[model samples]
Target: MPRFDITIVGELNLDLILYGLPESLPPERELLASRLTLTLGSSSAILAHNLAVLGSGVGFLSRIGDDALGEISLAKLAESGADVSKVRRARGSTTGLTVILARPESRHILTYPGAMFEMGFEDLDLRYLADARHFHVSSFYLHRALRHRLPEVFARMKAAGLTTSLDTNDDPDDRWDGELDQTLPSVDVLLLNAHEATRTARAANLEEALEKLSKRTPVLVVKTGAEGAIARRGREEYRTRPRAVETVDAVGAGDSFDAGFLHQFLRGADLERCIAFGSLAGAFSTTRPGGTEAFRDRAHFEEFFSHHSTAEADALPSPKPAPLQAKP
Candidate 1:
């Protein structure tokens, strides 16, 4: 067996969430938040942590500063049972961090890319990467230093006989400029939200976006929030509706979905089952405050899984691709 089920090459950071903030912040004013929370953050880190919690042997590869914040980030990630042996500590740079001002309806995030921007293709150890059965990368836009080298990295991973996935997350610049054409072909699976899918494809709608992207990526998965998620492979497509739950926060739902999807996928589960488990995991994430909170232990994960997953759902054979239906 491979040493690890999955190896994640991505960023590591912390999220400082301040709740009950004013809708608008005026410059040069002191404001108080009714609540504050500091938790492990970054799309990649969340994915690795939650995946490890879900019983996957996960390994994380990234760079962080040799600072207190970095120490905290590393400790939190290690606490989640993910292998942090490949994580490097850069001497001069500090770890990345995001400050979130949580409003009633929406949240504003301020990010400092710090050492997250310092990692590059050179920092990646191919020997370490070879130990995993699959590879995943996230937050494409945030990795400034490694942006240009991703295609080569993906190619290397593919050459090492590893299935690969990419979650570009949100492009802060809104200019989805990268080696997507070269990179997508190497990517076995590509995960995106509805907005990201449309933006990356430059299409008018989600269906059109999937149609275009599916041509490049072998499998395309789109996270549609409460509507659940949809996936396409070749001409085949599958979708799963989200489960109803009392949502605490939607911070890392998408990453959690990725973890769920990949968890079943690594087990050789079909796409339909993967989508269902992915949706179930995404919903479970919102029942708690942070990404990995709900799956903090095996008991929580098993209890939630047992309560939410039906035997029929798990045993159902993969269904035929349904007719293309546009999002309403």
Candidate 2:
């Protein structure tokens, strides 16, 4: 049996969130925030961290700079219970960092790719990768070095008897282009938000986008904020309503959903259960200022999960799978 339930290959970074900022930033003006937080950031790291917090044995591999920020990133990941022994520290580069200006309903992020851009397929250690039953990759566009080589990597992981998932976070270039045809076939699941799904499919609407993507990906999960999420598997579709919660910050909510869905998925839960749990996890994330804060420990996770379980049960019925027929 594999030593780890899941292994994540992606970028590592720190998020410095400045809260209580003005509605707009005027040029040449110095602005101050009422609150500030530094936390583990990066799509893949958040997913792995929350997955480990949810009790999965996770292994994480990424490239970081040999610097103070990199050290903090590694320490945070270690504290989250993910195996970071395989993470590499690249020389001559600084760790990636994101400065987030947090507003009431949205956030603006400025990023420095730094050493994260140095990682490529050659940097991966397959011997360590083979010890995980599953593999996941995220922030596709940001990982410039690995963009062209991911299909081969996924194929290799599959050949080594591991299931794989991909979440190509927003493409900064807006081109929405990647090795989808070559990569999706090797990926068991493709996770994306509504806008990303529509853009990736090059379609005019959500249903059309789902139809287009479902042709390439076996399982496609599209996150629809507030309305919850929808998933397509073969000719079937599964969906759940969002678990209502007071919002604090939306950072990392999607990654938290991925973690919840995968946590239940790895345990062989049905599609309905997976979607519901994912929604619940995502809702919990918004109760805190950052991605990993809401799930800082078992007690917090359990408390939120259990409390919301009852509330959600009383509010909505269990999700059911519906047949998805292509429109003529």
TM-scores for all predictions: 0.92, 0.93
Residue-level lDDT for 238 in candidate 1: 94
Candidate 2 Cα outliers beyond 4 Å, as residue runs? 310-328
lDDT of 1 by residue, 1-328 (tens): 6688889999999988888878888999998898887888899999999888777788899999999999999999999889999999999989989888877688888999999888988889988887778889999888888888888888888898888999999999899977767788779999999999999999999989989998988889999998999998899999889989888788889999998898878767778877888888889888876676777755766777777657425522122212222110
Against the reference, the lDDT scores of all candidates come to 0.85, 0.84
Clash count, predicted structure 1 = 0
State model 1's lDDT: 0.85
- For 1-328, candidate 2 gives per-residue lDDT tens digits of 6788789998988999999999988999988899999998999899999888877778999999999999999999888889999999988889999989999767898999998788988889987887877889989888888889888889999898888889988888899876766888899889999999999999999999999998888788999887899998888899888866888888989999998888777766667777788888888888887889888855777677667767445222122212121110
Candidate 2 structure lDDT: 0.84
TM-score of 1: 0.92
Residue 170 in model 2: shift from native, Å?
A: 0.5
Alpha-carbon RMSD of each model: 5.5, 5.3
